[model samples]
Target: MESTGGLRERKKLRTRQAISEAAIALFLEHGYDQVSVADIAAAAEVSKRTLFAYFPTKDDLVLHRIADHEIEAARVVRGRGDGEAPLDALHRHLRARLAERDPITGLCDHPQVVAFYRLVTGTPALQSAAARYVASGEEALAAALRETTPGDGRFAEVTAALAAGQILLVQRALAAANQACIARGMSADEREPDALAEADHAFGLLSGGLAPYRR
Candidate 1:
């Protein structure tokens, strides 16, 4: 039964991936607004009902990664090492991501990926969806901080919220810088050296006493 369940889960995942890829290709070829669920389903060789089962809305097809980021900051803060500060953990995580050429940095300048980014950044609907995801990230960070600094209550909550806001802002700045670099025809490897420098510059402002941990 467990093996069967595992196979079922893998099949579902493959189906989801196919649907998402199909949706993105269509959205890029035609404008996102011009593309419909039925269109994506047809492209993916699936039925509309099946597509809906995987992604209830068209926005979900595009903004899926944004939705996943909500818990990430909180997890970083909560899982910091005994001697590590929350900000330091986040910094290390980001630096490592830079080294890894993480996709969030707008490193992939492939036409489809660029179109996807432009689609999200340019579209009001997708922008709103991304904003909501970021807001959820703030809440998750605050909750994680509450758990970490248990006795302080309100102070911890406020500090965590502030940190989360700054972190997200830094993220936006990094992404913007990367996007600009890519738009200028810089390769991912070519962009990283400068992008990391800019990222460090942005992050430095938030470290130390800049936004002190209130709790």
Candidate 2:
């Protein structure tokens, strides 16, 4: 039998999923700004208070998926293989995700995923939330760099900031390009080769520029 803690966690997961699904349906149908947190909570059969307990802001309801990825850059840096350059590790991760057609790679053309892309692109609030996601990734990546580098000075800080910004710029560019392809009705699989090539090019630029300063 599952422990009480396990059961509570499972129940919480179910509630969160229900809330997210209901929120998505309303967001896609009526537009994000037109939908209220009250609307989402009512649709999910939860109280406004309960909904707020899970997601602090209206933006969180739609952008929690982005939150799921907030720590990914830091994880990539810390988990790189022995003898692997950090940018090389990141490049490999990006290539594998694009090849696998991960939705966050911006190559997935599945209906729900496309709807999410549309919702995010079409909503100002969601766009702000997405920006926050990128900002969080940059901070986490910078902290990881500062911790790992030889010194704890401004040089390490500036280098980390620049490197983090460059890596995220590459990711944003790739995501936007792939999203454009999806918008034009190309399947993610059909876009894989071009996307992979672009990933290589972007990372090649980063590796060449950032590797010298990396420790």
* Best by the lDDT measure: 2
Candidate 2: worst-modelled 10 consecutive residues by lDDT? 206-215
- Alpha-carbon lDDT of model 2: 0.85
Off by over 4 Å in 1: 208-211
Error of 2 at 36 (Å): 1.4
lDDT of 1 by residue, 175-205 (tens): 8789778878898888888878887777777
Clashes of 1: 0
List CA RMSD, all candidates. Answer: 2.4, 1.6
lDDT, model 2, position 182: 90
Q: Please give the lDDT score for candidate 1.
A: 0.79
